[model samples]
Target: MALMITDDCINCDVCEPECPNEAISMGPEIYEIDPDKCTECVGHYEEPQCKQVCPVNCIPFNPAWRESKEQLMDKYLRLQADAK
Candidate 1:
């Protein structure tokens, strides 16, 4: 599952650098996570790094978007590839 930041986000940007997948980015009002890129930090970390660092606890599951484990891994791989 990809996580999303609600309007509760303070735009502190603490979450951005913590994401191992580079899934988090600054949004117009709050930070946004690309579902195509977000992996819940599954392949990268023990937990979602953004959620961990976000003090406001704005990050929550994006029910509007969903994917399987394989799909998440595929996106992680693709993001990794793009980084290279």
Candidate 2:
């Protein structure tokens, strides 16, 4: 599953730079995660970096964009290709 930044986010600006896929960004009121670009750091790290650095624990798995580990890996591969 992709991760989402909840309203509980303190906008501490810690999560944005931590995303390996560059999926986290500033929204109108807080940080937002792009489901299309989010692979939950499956291919890049053992865990989601944003969640790891989030001081408030506001990042959570997005149920609406649920995906399996294999699917996330596929997305990560696609993203890597696109970056080239």
Candidate 2 error regions (>4 Å): none
The TM-score between candidate 2 and the true structure equals 0.98
TM-score, per-candidate, Cα-based = 0.86, 0.98
lDDT of 1 by residue, 1-84 (tens): 789999898888799999887778877777899887889997788788898999999999999988877888888888888888
Worst 10 residues of 1 by lDDT: 21-30
Q: Candidate 2 overall Cα lDDT vs. reference?
A: 0.95
Candidate 1, superposed: residue stretches over 4 Å from native: none
Model 2 / residue 1 / CA error / Å: 0.7
Best by TM-score: 2
Clashes of each: 0, 0
